[model samples]
Every structure is written in C-alpha cells, then in structure tokens.
Target: MHHLTGHRNIVELRGAYEDRHSVNLIMELCEGGELFDRIIARGHYSERAAALLCREMVSVVHSCHSMGVFHRDLKPENFLFLNNKEDSPLKATDFGLSVFFKHGEQFKDLVGSAYYVAPEVLKRHYGAEADIWSAGIILYILLSGVPPFWADHPWIREDGEAPDKPLDITVISRMKQFRAMNKLKKVALKIVAENLSEEEITGLKEMFRSLDTDNSGTITLEELRSGLPKLGTKISESEITQLMEAADVDGNGTIDYSEFVSATMHMNRLEKEDHILKAFEYFDKDHSGYITVDELEEALKKYDMGDDKTIKDIIAEVDTDHDGRINYQEFVAMMRNNSPEIVPNRRRMF
Candidate 1:
C-alpha cells in the first residue's frame, strides 16, 4: 500500500510503526464508507454513473498492473469513498491478499474471495489478467445490485452431481440484459474466459527470455528498440511505447517477461496462422481449396516427411468428413492442433 500510495484511486498509506510484537499501519480515513453501502444508499444508479465508476476502477487496476502489483482480492467492500459527496472518488483498499509479480510468472495460490476470484486463479497459474476478471465482477454487481455468480446459486453443484433444481432462467436473462447495456462489459467477460494453453505460454516465456539480452527478468526500452532489428524487424520509439502501454499492464518503466509475452502473443499466433495458410497453399497445387491424397504424397515427398502409408495415415486422421481430401479449414485445424510438431518443422518460403 505504501508503494502504491501516490495513486489517487488507491488508499494512501500515511505511516507505519513497528513494535516488538506487532506492526501498525496508519492509512487514509474514508468517512463516506464502503462502496456497497454507498450504492445501496443511492437505491439506483444510472448506466452513465456505473460506467464512470467502472472507468475509475479500471484506471486504478491499470496503475497496479503497470507497477507489477495484483490486488488478488478486489470486491465492492474493499472500495471506499473519501466523503459523502456525489463525486467522492472510489479508492481500493485492503492489500492483505495482494501480491507483486514479475513478468511471465504465474501464481498458483487460490487467494481471492469466491465471487470476485477469476476462474484461472482457482485453477492456479494465473497472471495480472485475474484482476481484470475481478473488475468485471465488480462491474456486474454495480449494474445489477447482485453478483453474477454466487456460492448458493442452484446452477453450481458439489461432487459433480446434477443439481435437483432447474437452472435459473432469470440469471441468463439478466446476463443478456447486461451485455446489451454495456458492450465493453461483454468484452471484459470474454477476456475472463480467454486463456493461453500451457504449451503456448511456455513458448512465450522462452521468447521473452531470448529477448531479455541482459538476462534481467524485465526488458528495458533500450533492449526493445535494439533487439527487434536483430530479429529482422525495426520499430520506432513511438511504436515501442504503444507496445509497452498495451502490454506493460503495470505502469513500470520496464517490460517484464509476462508483459513481453502478452503483448506479442497475438502477433506470434498471427505469424503461425500465416505460415499454416502458406503451407496449405503450397500443397493445394490445383487451386481447388483442398489437398487430395496425391497432393499430400507429393508435398510430403518434397520434405521427405514420411513413407506413403505414414502420409496416408496422417491425412486419414485429419479428413474428418471422410471426403478423401483435406480442405483449407481441415488443413488449418491440423496445423494448429499439431502446432508443436508442424511449426518446428515448417518450411520457410523465404
């Protein structure tokens, strides 16, 4: 909290005193009370008001992410207003479950409250994106006056048993209504569901380590500007800043491995997809949008990939429709699904 004191949206840590037995932290006083209480007192809030509050929440979270901090426990009760005024800024408090993380690192500890806890956090191996999930929960609660998920909700079952109660239709209706009201909130919800596979994450970590020339966990601006050219690409300072801003999540001046990976992961995917398409085009000699058994044999022969039988077996597995040919969709799926093997051996056109 002390390190994060300067941020307007965070509760200021005034001072701290440590004694033999214990330590005491003197923090800012928010007379207006908890955010939940304030919301109840308002009885109802306009979409504009909710959006304003949500923006403030994102700003603070963004600041925390920029600094490599994660407030694992983010809930309405943790937010307090400075005063009773209409514009009393909401400040995030309670750092008990908060943690600082290096770039590309993953946390396995299940530390947050259930309602605001992200799904990946529960599974472990979560990063800064967990906070974004919590923020989305807060946004849902702000709009609906109830959490989107609840411990007692009938839809949830223990022991993997089917629930006796019918799933609530109202919950689905509310979700639809919420999505209709806030498009950005819909995007945030989608982000909560987005996750990189373990293999992709591992590959990204390796990529980050390679770019970190000094072996430092974080990438400096100098390294970013100079290193890309070594990979046969050049980026201007402004572009570098934009990349940093997009990936840095924590406002820290340097890019941690996580930031580096997150920022470039999409680019990496696109490049792989391009390569897959090119490979497909190469095999589709007749421009028929499909690779027949003959084309597959010919393409495999060019690379000395496998025996005739081996090539046929490979195509047989990918030919889901059993049309005796692999269409562009099937070909792309095969490449992506077997990327670990295919990508490493992919022939570079250049």
Candidate 2:
C-alpha cells in the first residue's frame, strides 16, 4: 500500500497483523482526531488556513494518482490531524476504498463516504480524478463550514419519505450510501458549488511552469534550485536537496514533469481560481475578460504591478495574429506555454 500510494501525505503503513478471525494494521497515529471534529468544534476557519489545508490535500491526491493508488474514501473524517490542533498538518487515512490500477482498467466499485464522492463516480466509470473531487469537498468544508452538494432536512422527510431522501440525491446516491443524518445535509450541498474551474487550472499551470525549469516538462533538483529564487520558499538547502533527491526517479540529476505534476496535482483549483479571478476582475474594470492598456495602467497604480511595458508586451505576444487584443483563447495558449523561452519573461521575477 505504501509503495502504491507514493504520496507522503498518506499515513505510512508500517505493518499489519492478520488471522482467520481478525486483522490489524500498524499505522502512523496522528494526534489530531479528525478534520471533521475541528470544523464542527470551531464552525469555520480563516481563508489562509483553508488555503493551506487545500494545498496539503491536493499534494497527497496528486501523489496517489501518479502511483496509481486512488483514495476513494476522502473526507474530513478521513483526514487525520497530525497535531491535536486545528492548525495541525493533515494526513489522509482510511484506505478501505483504495484501489491499485491495472493497465487500461478504471475503477467500478462504488466505495467511499457519499457526501464527498465525485459526480463521475456516480455513473460508475471513474478513475483517480474521483479522489480529486472528494478533496474538493474537504476544501469547501474547511473554507465555508459546509459541503457543496446536499438537500434540506437530510435526516427525515416531512412528507413521510425515506430517511435517505434528499434533494442532492444525484451526488449522494453515488457515495455507496454514506449519507449523513439531517443536520449535515447542507454540508454536502456546499461542496457542489466549490468545484474546481478552468481558471484554476490556468493559475496552477503557471505555478507548475514557474517551478519547473529546463523545460523537460518536469522539475528536477537543478530546476527546483533554480526555482527557489521565484518561490521564496524558505528552507535549508540540504532539505530542498533531499526533497529533490526523493522525487528524482531516473538518477539523471533531474525530476521530470510527471514527478512535479504528481506532487502538486491535488491542489484545489477553485481556491486558487477564486483569489486569482478577483485580482484579474479588479484590473479588468470594463468587465471584459481581457484587460486594456488604460485599465492596466489604473490597476498598476493600485497594485504597484510590475513594469507597464511587460504587460503590454505580454498582450502583444499573445495576440498571435497581431490584432492588438488578447482573447481568452490566446491568453490561455500563452499561459499553458509558460517556459520563459516559449513565453519570454519581460518583467523581473517578482
């Protein structure tokens, strides 16, 4: 299971005991009871804390994906708190729904807590991405104190219907029947609204490109060292080197794109997109998807945004047909091709 998970966020399975009658597994015990407990106790968490939690969860999911292990059961209750505090780092636990992939084989077993299941999983033809959907639910809960997809009065129907009947049945029905009681119905509904979006993908791609140097579509030791200047992530050089070595698979002194993507793939696109879009919207005063020169100038005044010429240059470069205006398609094309050589950095790293 450890070899299959490949993600550091999972609790390490040191050993297991099994007999004809019973079985036990020795696993890392996190002091924190569970993320669900913290959320219920506190009601809500700050945006920064929410962001951090999402970051950690996404990272774990990404690792599971690369190694072909899918944590089909991911929810606040399954998230083990490493320290007995709300701020403690989280470790995803409960792999009862976990599966190891075979070539061309996709998951069909309907397993996991219902509230956090992915929509695709409901149809029964799903893969590792389903885990991503569950992580998104946790993110919504941490940030908004509620899940995105649920119905009103989840516990009992005023109309004398079954206890399991809820308006948010579409997603919940796919959870292998893990629906919560009435009080927690709204929590699931909240998750549906916080689903990841395309804009979030764009922002993450930029982050990935900035960290991945040498353009081998991956981040190796040398690339990570080079990217430190950009991330401003403070840590010992030795530690960073260790992380790089741990991720390096070919012993070619570099980490490939797969390794880097796998490491960060679990990041919640919604959280990233929401913040980035606000900034973009503020700069685009005219309500247009693209910012104009005048609007850009005003935004620069407020943001102390880098050199004006850099923005103009970007707009022009993306206007491949030289039409003097950048559209969503052009902007996305440029964003996807993030290498400096492919998309020159006209401004300073900052």
Candidate 3:
C-alpha cells in the first residue's frame, strides 16, 4: 500500500508504527463500508453503474500493476466507498497478500480467496496476469451478482438466456476438464449433456468472453476460473490448478490451440501417419529428418514452451538411440505413448 500511496483508487496509508510484536498502519477511513453491503442495501445496480464500477476496479488493478505491485487476493470485500455519497470513489484496501514483482518473474506461493484466485496461481507458476485474472472475476461478480463458476447459485439457475456464442476450443478443453470428469467417464456414462456438437457447445453464455477483453487469441487463466461455474462443475481450487497444469502441454504458462488439441484429441487422429510426421516436421525444421537439440530448443522456444534446460532434458530422454538427437522413429514412439505432450514430465509424455 505504501508503494501506491498517491494513487486515486488506493487507500492512502497515512503512517506506520512498528514494534517488536507487530506493525500498525494508519489508513484513510472509508465510512461507506464494503461494496457488497452497498449493493445489497439497495439492489443489483444498473448495467451502467456496474460498468462504472468495473472501470474503477480495473483502474485499481492498473494502478497496482503499473507500480510493480500485485494484489494477490482481490475480492468484493477488499473494496470500500470513500464516503456515503453515491459517487464516492471506491478505495482498494487489504495489502496483506500483495507483493512487488519484476517483469518476467513468476511467483510460486499460492495465496488467494477461493472464488477469485486464478488457476495459474494454484498451479504455482504465475505473474502479473494472475492479478488481472482476479480483477476480471470481481468484474464478473459485480455484473451478475454471483461468481461465474458457482453454478449452484440462485442467480446462475435463474439465468436462462441462450448462449450467444460458442466457447473457443481451448475454453472447451477447460470446461470439459473442469466438469469433474475425465473424458473416459463422460464416454462411459454416455454423457453428451455438454451439447457435444462440433458447431457449438451449449449451456454457456458469454462465459469465456467475460474476461477476454483484448481477444488476444489465447485462453487466459482468468477465463477458465470464471467460466467453470457456468458448466455447473465445482471442484477444489487445488483440482482447478491441477486441471490447468495437466492440460498445458507446452508449459508456456498459457494454453493455446495446439496444446488443447494435442492434449484432448482422439487417438486415431493423433496417431495418423501423416499427423505424426507433421508433428515431427514442426520440430525438425529445415526438413532435416532428425530433431537436433538446437532444433528442439528453437521449435519449443517459439511457443515459449519452457527453459533451455527443460527442453534439453526432453531431447535427451526422447533420443532413445543415445544419438544426441531425435529421429522420426524415436519421435513416433514417444508420440504413440499413453500421454506424451506433457512438458514437465517426459518419462511418460508426448
């Protein structure tokens, strides 16, 4: 909070007193109380009001990020109106879990409230994007009066509008993965209930789009957490984190289209001779017929796959012939294995 002392939306820290046992902060008082109470005292506000609040919330986020600070735990209760006036500025408080971060740094500590935590945080690898994830969820709650993943809530059930768009394929991987079942379970139970149409997966509305404000062409971890509830699937935050790490085949910290399809596509399609060769050719640039360690790093680095050491480790393990390079035969064998595309674990991966 001291780092953000002069920000318009952040609560100003007047002073601090430190003792042997603790440190006390003198903060500007906000007599208007918590945001939820304000909403409940009246009712859900108009979309215009919600839009205004959303902008303010995002501004708080931008203020923090611009100052190299990350508010690790952001939820409705952390926001307070400065005065009783309707237009009083909302101040962001509670820096208990906030931390200063440098660009390209990744935090491993998992600390956040249940509903607003991003999946990457749970997976123990995240950056500034994680805080953005939290703010987006807060925006979703302000707009809908309920968390997006909380399918059991009255607001979720009461919302009966048809889905306006088909979720992206990457989003589908997240929704299906988070549905508390592996693909085999769905197949075993004859569960086509997700409206398994190739054209559109039904029963979800504006789910992924809520946080894709930039439409940057990749699935944000924030979108996954916010969308899971619409599918009526609830899981422990730990499981949600695991679901992301499990599906992120490239280890790029975000799931992309190829990673999604590589992780979930049918075996027949995956093992097609042409498909396997194409996959190899992707890495064996220059049509060299062999994936040298340099070739491996170059290909994987393009996807921001992982560090050089991890990429080299993959090359070493996949080169079954001990040739310091991966040939078509070795590549095919690895791809044919039960689960291969996993970047973290190569002993049993694609």
Candidate 4:
C-alpha cells in the first residue's frame, strides 16, 4: 500500500494482512461499483466522456509501463470511479497479473482474463504491448457499449478442436496458425480485428444511428433485440442465450439498457479468468498438481498443430529454472510473475 500511495491514478491502499489460507487486502471501496456499472447505468457515455476515460487509462498504463509494472488485468471491473458521481475520476486497480520487466527480458507465462488478452499471450509469448491491446478493447466498449467479441452461441466442436480464426488484422503479418483458437478466442479477436476498412466503419456508424432508435445517442436492449436481429447473420440460439445469461446480472430475465451495456463491456474481463483456469487444466491433464513438458506439448499442439517445434521453444523459454518439469504452483507463480502486459505504478514486478 505504501508503495502505491503517491500515484495519481491508482486506487489508494489502506491495509493488508496474510491469513493462513489467503491474503486479505483492504483498499478503499469503490462507491461507484465499477466503471462498467456506470457505463451501463448511462446506456453509453458521451463522446467526450469516452475520450476522457480512454485518455486517463492511457496515462495510467503509460506510467505503469515506464515503471516496468504492467497491469495485465485491466478491465472495467478493475477500473473504479472516484465516487458515485457521474463525472467521477477513474482509477486503475488490481495488480494480481501485473509484472515488472528488466531490459532484454521476455514474458512467457499465459495469464490474464480472456477477452482482453493479446493474441500473443494465447500463443504463450507476449510483452507489455499486450496491455495496450487490451486497453484498445476497453476504448471500443466505452464507445460502442458492447464487447467486440459478443457472439450469440457457444460454438462447440465435436472433435474438441479449436475454432477457425474469425478476426481480420492489419498489423499482424501471419495469422494462419490462429485457426486453432477456441470459440472464445475467435470471438475475442473481433475487437482487435484489422479487417475493418474505413467504409466498414462508416457502415457501422450508420447501423448504430439506426439502432439508436430513440435518438438518445445510445442503443437500448429493446432496440437491440428487436432491431439488431435484422443484421441477417445466422447467430446461434445458444449464443443469444449465453449473452442474455451474461447480461442478466440481477437474475432478471431481461436486461435494462444499462445492465445490458455494462455486461457486454465487462465480458472480455470475465473471459480472462476462465482462460487462466483453462491453461491450468491444459497442464493438469491427469488431475495431478504439476505440469510436465509433455502436457505442455499436448496443450500447445491444439494451437501449434503443424508447428510442434514452436511449442518446444516456448516450453524451454518458460522453464527458466531449468527444471525438467513445472509444478502447478510453480506455473501459477510464474504466470503471476511473468505477465509483462500488466504494468502498475507501485512496486516493480519480476
């Protein structure tokens, strides 16, 4: 807490204690709940507010990166409002996935929430630049009031293989290997997809204008369900069901405009934890509490497919202590320690 006290954008830490089974951290409670809640309550923010939020986040991330403390777990839930006020200042919180980097160091652990994780992380090698990718997703949510990866149904494969790539990227030179990403990964990449052209943006804006049926500068749930279906895409029934389930935070059958927007905006963050658990499962095939290079290879095979050598290279890089195998605890700690995308303003992460 003391190490984080002076940062203008970080939440103030009050006290902490370590219990036998868990560590308790007590920080200032966010009266505003989450930035996601605020965004949902207001349907969508004004352009100025969205821009302000993005700028502030960028500044915070910039500070973290400069200090070699990356906040890899940035999301709406991790962002708190100064208070419940409409114009409350926001602060970035949560350092569980944050990391500190040394010159020439490379981060190889796979951690962070699913929706916001960079593509490279899924491949098992990424750096601080991954955080910037997540930040971009947040900006998209603030402006669009919906996650970029919002899909209507779970695309389950009978063969248990991952899904084919659905996103288009401009900066990436190679994505042929991405076809093996799971349903969640395929969907998540849409937010960072580069396939969109200027004409597409204009078309999307037109669609948004049409969906803003009430001319309120926001699209309501009623409008979405009634009008968005007109898009002519064959969305899965299960997909819509999952979306509704995800959005109904109060357990109600229907989502209010705010609740709807808030849920979508935070969906990416929700996926992050799930991905970590999946990664753990990948290494714990026998339900054992440890990970072996063989298990890692099998897991990577799902994505690396024809490129088995690549998987071996990644395992060698992460086995920094040169142990023949990694225990679960070691893997977990390594993930917590090596996430380069998380930059915090507090103490350095190693």
Candidate 3 C-alpha lDDT tens digits along 129-237: 8878888887775665445663434554436532333233334443344344332222211222221333222222243343343566555566656645454545567
lDDT of 4 by residue, 77-97 (tens): 789987887777788898887
- Please list the Cα RMSD from the true structure of every candidate, rounded to 1 decimal place: 23.3, 21.5, 20.6, 23.7
Model 4 poorest 10 in a row by lDDT: 168-177
Name the lDDT of candidate 1: 0.63
User: Which residue segments of model 1 deviate by more than 4 Å?
Assistant: 151-155, 158-350
Best by lDDT: 1
Candidate 2, which ten residues in sequence have the lowest lDDT sum?
180-189
- Candidate 1 or 3, higher TM-score? 1
Please list the C-alpha lDDT of all candidates, in the order they appear. 0.63, 0.56, 0.62, 0.56
Looking at model 3, residue 105 earns an lDDT score of 91
lDDT of model 1 at position 9:
86
Model 3 stretches with alpha carbons more than 4 Å out = 151-350
lDDT of 1 by residue, 178-268 (tens): 3232211122222221344554443345445545778889978776666555533344678655554444444567877544543433222
